[model samples]
Target: MKNCSNFTNDVVYSIIISFISVSCIYGQIPVENDTIEDIEDFDIIDMESTLVEEKKDSISWVSDVFSAMRLGIQYGFTYKAEKPDKIMNNRFSFRLEYSKSFLEYLSVHIDTKMFTFLKNDHRIRDEEDIVALEGRTREAYLQTSFNKTSIKAGIQIVVWGESDYAIVTNEIGRLDYREPLSLNMDDLRIGQPMLTIDQYSSFGYWSAFFVPYSEFNEQPRKGTGYYYDPFDGKVEYLKEKQKGNFSEYGLRWRKTFGKSDISIMAASLIDNQYALRMVNPDLITKSKQRFFMTGVTFNRAINNLLVKGEVAIKSEKAYNDASFQIVKKNALDASLGVDYSPNSTFTLSIEAVNYHIMDWSDQIQGIPRNNYIALLALSKQLMKNNLSLSWASMYNGPYTNFFNVLSASYNWNDHITLNFDALIPIVDDARSGFYPYRDQKQVAFRVLYQL
Candidate 1:
């Protein structure tokens, strides 16, 4: 605690001052308003009219196009918690995004990021992969609107759950696990190629998605710092599927009742998570399995507490047995969460999750029979949300294990911010879920400047 407290104080002071200085300089630059014109008075109605005119003249669906740009730079350092060698987790990252609405029916958005690690870069393979540039599409997509129907096409990140993190009903896209024990849950998602169509009506909204291309989530290679890799310098690969099908599709129906948001969704697609199938002399391989998934989610507020829940059923799940044979099973998972905002700056949330298999096989020793997990999250904002702190913990019932995260964020201004995060785990010495890297405690910090 002493070390962490000292690190937090030092980094917060230096980063806040430096970031605010830069933001002030940037904001002081003389930049005139884009929609400037001769107006009679500063009345609210006149200002609204001016904004409407600006949208009508320049951008059809948006007020301004140049305000779509977002840029940021961040740096962090991490490593194994126990006896570790030299520094292996030093990383630098950059991000950029631009979006615009060109016509009444069409709009385009593009986002991308790059990563550079200074030393002991586990993701790097030889010289080519060093300082890799990833998330190129981040979310490059095009949208069109016609009547009550809208369509979005191209590579995009599609999330379909009401949960804050550890999503249960979200089964459309893949997850990126290169950086494990991360504080930002959204950063863990990776986009896929899909075309979505939505039609709105008084009853509700009906949405459909077509996902043709199929690929599993990326994993750490043999040389990566991720504990999953055996570190034999051999690649961790996935076995080829018998055939690639282009008919994967999903459907979602959502509606609002009073103050409750309810949604039901279904999808038939190849699952992104893979299970170890066979082992070769030089290569470790996994296999992907197709699944039919359906779920219902809801959110509502009563008094000062907000309640959220989702239940998902999977028709097929791939796993391994002691005999090394891949077993397919049906699974059901559900989560219920409640959040209470006792005051303006503090909030507390409690969530319960349960998972069960419809049919259990004695041969299946690798998979847990059932699970009862509880998650508690607390967050507070100070200085009018300019300074914030969040702490969350997840307890695994069967294994008696815990996963905890504590993070602090300081907004130097509208454009610059600093973040510090610590990941701590409590588990038995024997292997359990999240057993690997259980002792690899991590503390990471990043400063971002964006507009």
Candidate 2:
């Protein structure tokens, strides 16, 4: 069975590679209606009449092919924040996008990223830069209308919550935490394949999703400081077929009335939050496991301030035992956040969250029964909207640990921009989340050109 699964995976990957290679070589283009060589086969007057009708409603595929495309390039580098050393992330990347409307009811969007990274260090390079070049389809989806309902198919991104900087109700997509707290939530999500259906009415909107597969979070490499390897290097990965039953399915209902918006959502998905989890008494899991999450969220504008709140209960999550086996448990989390933009150039926001474990035992040593996290964010724009500065900090109240970041960006022009960011951590206990990343303080800069 294992051999067969490996063969199937290899074939799928090989087919994908071949498809990309052929596409790059051929550069297939849409056909123009007026460029047909066999014009004698059709009446010229009828063709002209059809063209006129198309101009009134439908768009010419030839002219619409690349009309909505955007392409750009960026270069970035990163180093230790406090102590300058050799660059850890030396990157040059290409960003591409193409979108077009086939009809009033149908549309398509494509986004892709290709990048390379280089590291020359002995220890770090072995684990990270082993594969310096990578490419992936960020989003390639087709959306169409079915009566009053709209459906989207293919690989795409879906964010399902209101609060920022923390995960309360937004647990759908696979998150990439390779750099941990160095990056924000927006940059940490990875697209996945799903079928989404949305329907809107005077009362509210309803959404449903059927996801065929699930994925684990992309964590730091084994040699990295934040890598979670309780077994040092001994771990086992379950066969792909063994995980075939872990399909993800979800539903959400949202409503807006007056100045307030509310939603309720539920999903059966894998718990990808934990990077290292034990699967059995003798084995540890190399990927995420099954879990269920149900939550409610709300947001409202109260005069000058906007408030958002979420409460989620997750079940079937695994907790490690002293003997190394994992035990399934339930956890509940509640959070509230409020944001205020006193003026056009400045904004302030604060969030508070509390988590409780329904099933607590002595084997869960590092985790507390009742834990809390507090967060604050501030941003300001200067120089007439060209220069911007922002700072965000998150405090783990139970452990007295903090994660802070400060960023500055300047838009040189409509076509060029520059960004600088720093990540700093404060840890007082070894069990804190930031303790693993304490030595990972880093500074990064990027220059981007919009094409």
Candidate 3:
């Protein structure tokens, strides 16, 4: 993606693109009403009446065309607590989506997003500038359905697993880690291009996917508040490029029984997280290793309580030693969560996660052999469900790191919404990833309008 600093033009361009693309792709829009008249009893008055009806029909068609398309726009900003006058993020975003069914068994969908970063400052590095105009096609796909089977191709988002807060098996889609602590959970995923086949049978629902060109996680740019500096001194960094092969595939089978759901999945893929390879004390390179992973997830609802868990085993995972040398080891990841909802307006969720490296070694550079994390979330709605309030907290067991977020959202009406979020990070150990921005507490405000 290319970045430009023209904010007004970018916003106008996004609006024009949405309308033009939708009109062009649809070509002929179907109208529901048909005006009929009698020719034998026609006169000048009847002719004028018929012409007026035709004009109304034309207006109705245009209205229907515009109403059928989905459009949304959002503007938000974050303010740092330490530097009250400084703005951390000022973003304006637009989204457009259009879907159509061409045949009984074939359909297509297009979703696009545009973002304009209105903040320009020193924190935004020149090497990888984050403050500018950017756009992406969130999803553009064609699908065919036959009886109990369906096939889809194009850019898409796939979600797998049952645990919340901790990612155990939902590794198929890449995640955005650029502003890890500030982003909402629902907006953290980035779409990937792939072909998928899903089949429904008496046994279960089977799904298989092939990603020809898989992508890695979106990391923070250098000089950003969230960027992590591994080495203190200057070091040369290099990334190894894959020559010709770029493929990742996975299979999943899910079944439902009463109020319970279970799924098992396996994949051969390159890790999204990179490992450092030390060329020397002053040189280090970021690289990813291929690995095999298999996992299972299940969720069951009982009374007012819901329980979910996931466990995965990965072979030949990549890691860095104390000397920054690369090492391969097996690892196990597991997470369990429980939700208690006493009423429709209030809910609480608690989760625990663990990551263990087999063939343990104390020489691991950043991660401990056994890492544990605890999470808690509570949410409530009031004002006839127009106002929502939530609080989420996370704690690292070994590092004594603590992170918390408080959020509130209010619906002004059917088309407008206002949101506010506060993020707080307490770093007890310098080894913790959150230590880099220990003093960067922030409060964010957002307004969204649907068109």
**Model 1: per-residue lDDT, tens digit, 1-451?**
6467557655755675556455544544433662212121233345446555653564443335557777788776665556563445677788878877776789988887887776466665554554654444468889998899989998888778877766688878787777766645688877778899999999998989998777667666556677474444565566655666635788999999988999999999787877666575555566667889999999998988999999999987887787566788999999999999988899999988888877887888756678788989999999988999999998886767898999999999888899888888887845466778667677767788775
lDDT of 3 at 62: 61
Q: lDDT of candidate 3? A: 0.81
For model 3, how does the per-residue alpha-carbon lDDT over 1-451 read when each residue is reduced to its tens digit? 1133235445754675556445444543433562222222233345446555765676576676666589989988888787534677778889998876665899888888998876543245563665777787768999999999999999998878776577778878888888778525457778889999999999999999999976888887787656776665488788866576568899999999999999999998878887778788778888767888899999999999999999999999998887778889999999999999999999999999998999978777788888899999999999999999999999986877899999999999999999999999988698787787788788889999998
Those runs of model 3 whose alpha carbons end farther than 4 Å from true positions after fitting are 1-64, 83-85, 120-131
Best by lDDT: 3
Pairs that clash in candidate 1: none
Q: Which stretches of candidate 1 lie over 4 Å from their true place?
A: 1-65, 79-81, 125-136, 230-238, 244-247, 279-285
RMSD of every prediction: 13.3, 12.1, 9.7
- Taking all chains together, each candidate's TM-score versus the true structure is 0.80, 0.80, 0.85
Q: Give residue 362's lDDT in candidate 3 (0 to 100).
A: 79
Compute the lDDT of residue 194 as modeled in candidate 3.
Answer: 94
lDDT of each: 0.76, 0.77, 0.81
